[model samples]
Target: MTVHFHEASQSVTTADAAYAGLDERHAVQSGPGTFKVYRALGKRIFDIVCVLMALPAVLPVVLIMMILVATDGGNPFYSQMRVGRHGKSYRMWKLRSMVQDADAKLKDYLESNPEAKREWDHSQKLKRDPRITRVGRFLRKCSLDELPQLWNVLRGDMSLVGPRPMMIEQRDLYPGRDYYALRPGITGLWQVSSRNESSFADRARYDALYNRELSFFTDLRLIVATVGVVCRATGH
Candidate 1:
C-alpha cells in the first residue's frame, strides 16, 4: 500500500501497463481469486452497508452543516459533474465548501495571481483559496464537506473506497484507464495517502496502484485510514 512518485514519463507508461496486466489477471484469476468477487460484487454491497450504518450519525452533522452553509445565502449542497466508472458522468454531491460564486472567484483569482494559477494548473487545488467561506473552511478541514457523497455511494455512482472522482474536464489529464474500471470513491488510496503533497498528475498512478491491489482487505484498510485522516483534520 505504498505510493511511489515516479517521474512523469515513467509513471504514465507504468500505470498504463499495470492496468492492462490487472485486467488480464482478473479474468484469469476470477475463479481462484475470491478478491475478484469482492471487486465485482462485494464492494458495492459493502458501500451500501457502510453508508446505511453511518447515516444515522452522519445525518445530524450534515443537517447542521447545511444550516451553517446556507447562512451565506445560497444552496447548502453543491453537485458537480465528475467522471465515473466507464467514463460515465455523474453529479457528485458535497456540502458547499466555497462561496456561492466559487468558480467565478477562482477564475478571477487565478487570472490575477500568476503563482496561484501555476499551483492550480499543477494540482487543481489551492492551499489558500479565497473562495472558501469560514464555515466551509472548517467543514473541508474536518472532511465533513464530503459527507453528502454517501448518497452517491448508495446510488451506485461511487464507492466507499476507490479513486477520488475527477472533474469531467480532467479526464484527459488522467494518464491511466484504471480510473474508468471502477466507481469513483468518497475516499481512496490517494485521499488516505499524502494527498495534499501530491501533484494532480500523480493521481492516475495511485489509481492504477489501487486497482492492481484491489481487494477486500485493501478497501478495508483504506476506509480505516480515511477515519484517521478525518480525525486528524488533514483534509483541505
Candidate 2:
C-alpha cells in the first residue's frame, strides 16, 4: 500500500491496489481527477467519542494533579503555543511540570553545563534537567504530566492518535510539508513506538510513516500500544 498526500486539498490519498474499497463515510475528496479515501472525518468522530468516554476517569486525576503542581507556587497548568493542523496555532496545555522560570533556568543551565547543552541542542530535552521540580520529576516519569492534554483533545486542538504536536520553533524539524495536513495528537505513533528514547530524526520518520499509512485500524493499534507503553513505565 502506498499513501500520497495532496497539499492543495489537505487530504491523504491511499493507493493500494490489493486493498478493497473504503466505506463511504471515510472517503475524502481528492482534487479534480483523483478520488482519495481516508479516515480524516471518521477519525474526528472517533476522537470525540474516545475523549468523552475517558473524561469521567480522567477528570478526577486532573484535579488532583492540578493541586499537586501548584504546591511550589505558580499556575498549576501550563499552556504553550503549538502548531496544529494546516500550520495553525493553538494553545497546548499541560500540568505544570517544571519551575515557573523553567525557560530562564534552561538557558542558564545550558551555559554552565556543556554536556547538558549538547543534549538539549540535539534533542531539545535534557535527561537531568535542573528546571524540573521534585513533584514535576515524578509527574514526568509516569506520564501524568500529560493528562491535561485530554482537554486539548476534547477541544479539537488535538486528536487521540496522530503526530505529536511540535513547538513553533521545532516545525522545521519535521521532514516534510505533508505533516501539516494532520492535526497533532496527545499520544501517537512516535509515543508508543519509542516514547522519549527515539532521536529527533527517528521521531520525524515515524510521524511521516504514520501519516502515510493512516487508517482506522492503524489508529486503533497505536492506541492499544500506548496503554502497554504506559503500563511498562517506559514513557518520558
Candidate 3:
C-alpha cells in the first residue's frame, strides 16, 4: 500500500527513506502512502472533461432541485466552509437538503431525543433525521444534494474523484496533512464503498487510500460504481 512520494522538492532523502523503511517500531508515521505525481495533470484534465460532459444533464436537474428546495420556503442552495487541499478552506456548495435553521433544529432535536443525540455523537448523522425536509430527504437519498458541487469542480475547488472534504472540526482526524494534499470530491471511495454505514475512522482510511491509489483506471471505476450507488438511492 506504500507508494513512494515524488516531486524533487518533496523528495525523500536517502537518510529519510532508510528511516521510513526501518522496522515498524522505528518507522516514521508519514501519513498514508505517497502522492502519485504523474496522475496530477491527468486527474485535473479528467475532472474538467467529465464535468463539462455532464453539465447538460446536470444543469437541468440542478434547476429542478432548486425549485423544489425553494418551495420549502428557504434558500435553495447551501454553502459551508470545508477543508480543502493543503488545509486551505473553501465554500463547498450543495443544494439545500435541510430545513431552515437546520443547526438550531438539530440542537433542539438532539436535546429532546437521547437516542438521536447518541447517533449524532457517534456518526455525525442520523438515519432518520428530523431536520431534513421531505424533498431534502429524497434529494439526499439520490445524492442530488451534491449536484451544486459541479461548480466547485469547475472552479478547481474540488476534483471529480478524491477524498470527501471534512469539516474544520474533523481536522485532527486526518492521518496527517496527507489528507490535505488532494482536493475533496463530491463522491469518493468512501461514498461508493460504505457511505454513512462506515465509521468515521474507516472513512478516513478510505480517504487516504483513495489519495494514494489515484489513476485513470481508479477514477473510472469509482465513478462507475458511484452511478450504481446513486441509482440504488443508497447515498446519504
Leading candidate by TM-score: 1
Residue 79 displacement in candidate 2 (angstroms): 0.6
* Model 2 per-residue lDDT tens digits across residues 114-219: 9888787676777777888988877776678888887888788988777778889987766666457788887766665444445567666667777766777667
Q: Clashes in each model (backbone N, CA, C under 3 Å)?
A: 0, 0, 0
| Predicted model with the maximum lDDT | 1
Give me the runs in candidate 3 sitting further than 4 Å from their true place: 1-38
What value of lDDT does candidate 3 attain over all alpha carbons? Answer: 0.72
TM-score for predicted model 1 compared with the true structure: 0.86
Give the per-residue lDDT digits (tens) of candidate 1, residues 49-135: 999999999999999999999998889999999998999999999999898888999999999999999988887878899999999
lDDT of 2 at 21: 44
Q: Report the poorest 10 consecutive residues by lDDT, candidate 3.
A: 1-10
Residue pairs with colliding backbones in model 1 are none
Q: How good is model 3 by TM-score? A: 0.81
Q: TM-scores of the models, in the given order?
A: 0.86, 0.81, 0.81
